[model samples]
Target: MVRAAGKHTSARLVLICVGLLGIALIADFLWASSSSSRFALIGANWAPPVSLLTPITIPNKGVDSQKNNTTTGRVLSATFADLPAPELKWEKMAAAPVPRLDGAAMQIKNLLYVFAGYGTIDYVHSHVDIYNFSDNTWGGRFDMPKEMAHSHLGMVTDGRYIYIVNGQYGPQCRGPTSHTFTLDTETKKWQNMPPLPVPRYAPATQLWRGRLHVMGGSKENRHTPAVDHWSLAVKDGKALEKEWRTEVPIPKGGPHRASIVYNDRLYVMGGQEGDFMAKPGSPIFKCSRRNEVVYGDVYMLDDEMKWKVLPPMPKPDSHIEFAWALVDNSVIIVGGTTEKHPITKKMVLVGEMFQFNFDTLNWSVIGKLPFRVKTTLVGFWKGWLYFTSGQRDKGPEDPAPKKVIGELWRTKLNLGS
Candidate 1:
């Protein structure tokens, strides 16, 4: 498990415990192996003296047709599923065209905006796509002028605009670029935003109280994932045209691009800084390195944006493609590749999902991914959590972007409680 004040792991149902400040709530999943549940949300929590909301799981068996939902300038597949028992309905908001590992997404209103990602494609893509759930249609696509790809790009949305933070151009998979961009939801346009003080890939970005904060990513010189934390005002998009000024640094280790906003703070999860070189389309394949993944740690920013490393990820796996979500009211980190196995040298798919709580800094267990999500973008919508599209490559024998999934799956949280 991630962390709990009491240090117990058998928490399936959540509870509230009275504490000094006020109260806190806790919960967990009594997950069973034979579970084939649909996207559902249930009212559950831990009453360990504090009170909080926790989402319980219910199995589902319904399915929907795989349809395409274009989100602006990006190519993605969207689908829908209704969990009957729980009466929860959801639509697949957005997806990346192919197996784009280490990709990211931003949500605004009914649409989900997807940004740069890398995979089988030879060149880095700076394209941005948005998906509208209301009309089940994709808006026009926009390009990220910078040659962007391969980054664990941290993403954030102000319910009106989407912003991109630190990412580097790599010669390994595709290449790297030192740039930042933001999408204006109203204008449906992308404007060059402020650039980071340093050029790094896979740093985390989040929004709180109208300000944008960026932390962690690998610089060209391979400095320990930039521990610096920077903040800027998102005043009428003018900030994009300038440079990113610096704030406080983490004062410890660095953070990866995999970040999530919970209870108003940015929880930056795993990622590492290394010398990576991809053949043509692969990113993070460093020279002299076995294409292995690193960074077994996790951390979060306080309301003040200060850094505090939390419990590391569940097991051990690394890939700029690694993704995280807040499913079932628990912070869930999922799929990415690792070069641990020689046969599948470049990358190997992961189905594991790790859940941790933002409050107690406690970690718990969760289910595996139901689909092959190689290039995944995580998000929450209408009471559900989503894993966007990704890809897989066959062993050298039939090596190609084997499975490019346009499928979208949701594990929603019941807001009825």
Candidate 2:
């Protein structure tokens, strides 16, 4: 009886072990099937089959659209889709004729025109340089009617002519001017147009519907701000001899903001309300107080002629003095400075790049540049972005020399579906 009982106990133990193994196998098979189906649904439309058990490591070639061949029997149908993202390729082009900062650049046909700003040795300049895309060369140097240099000057083009509006000229921000000029690309001549109603520096300006609209800037030195908006009335398809008519003012006008017209709507972004810089030994500078207010608010002018505030920009503190250009319904903003440092009181340069989609109302970071930059001349032409001379560092003081950049950079913009 004892032997029979012992044998019965052993049999029962073997049966329990087999039952656990069968249960585990069933659970694993069910999990694998579900995972494979989910991945197939997500990736079958675009990517090849893959296995979930095998890890995927994307190579550093360019984009992640290539397929992975590693597989496991349990997860044979798992795969990943190629996401829609911007593919960028940056290359160094020919250097500019002169090194400068805070200049304006515009593109017409196959030519890129760059206007005056602060040169490396001079406080201001009236020089103009042209880049020919056909030959990939820089030539056609001309001079403006007067010296123009400031942190923020408004410039636009209508394919035949380039218009420049109010800006400052001096070693310091002491000479705010209301002067406006237009350059005839065919004649290579600068002609005086109606000046702005108010003398301001860094006012946002754009050309829309046969009229030039100007708004917001520093009124009289970089201390006081202006919120006025004016549009030049067109006569006989020309803006000559036309007076500026007052329109709806911007809700929160500031200096050095970027203004652009896209799809018949005006959009403005990034500026400061107060003095951007203070004297090195001043109380505000020494104490490292946040005297200047950098804004990240984005405003748009609708068809009704009313200003509608859009979603605020991301990374508000570091959105000042960046260069902006529109490419295929997307707004691209590159490189700017952050607020003053608490201890050193110096502004920090941010090298981040971002793109805003108009249809989706979303902002995404594209990539960082090779170096930090601000007040750079940027324009998009024929699927390539041209960035010219700009300042890599703040202006020098006393014995130190100013560091101006002279290289031209070109990048191919690849939009993926």
Best by TM-score: 2
Global fold similarity of model 1 (TM-score): 0.63
Prediction-by-prediction clash tally: 61, 0
Candidate 1 stretches with Cα past 4 Å from truth are 1-99, 119-121, 134-139, 146-152, 169-175, 221-224, 240-243, 251-256, 278-293, 303-306, 317-322, 327-329, 342-348, 393-404, 411-417
TM-scores across all candidates? 0.63, 0.71
How well is each residue in 1-417 modelled by candidate 1, as lDDT tens digits?
A: 367834553343233233422422222132431222311211121111111122222223422112232222111111111101212244544444544544567656666666656554433446666666565555567776554444556567666767766565543343345567766778877777667676665666777556777776655544445676777778665573255567677544343436667777766665555535443333454433423245546666666656776665543344433366555456656565432333333444455455666656655434435532354666566655666766644532222236755456666554221
RMSD (Cα, Å) of candidate 2? 13.7
Q: Per-candidate RMSD vs. true structure?
A: 16.0, 13.7
Relative to the true structure, candidate 2 reaches a TM of 0.71
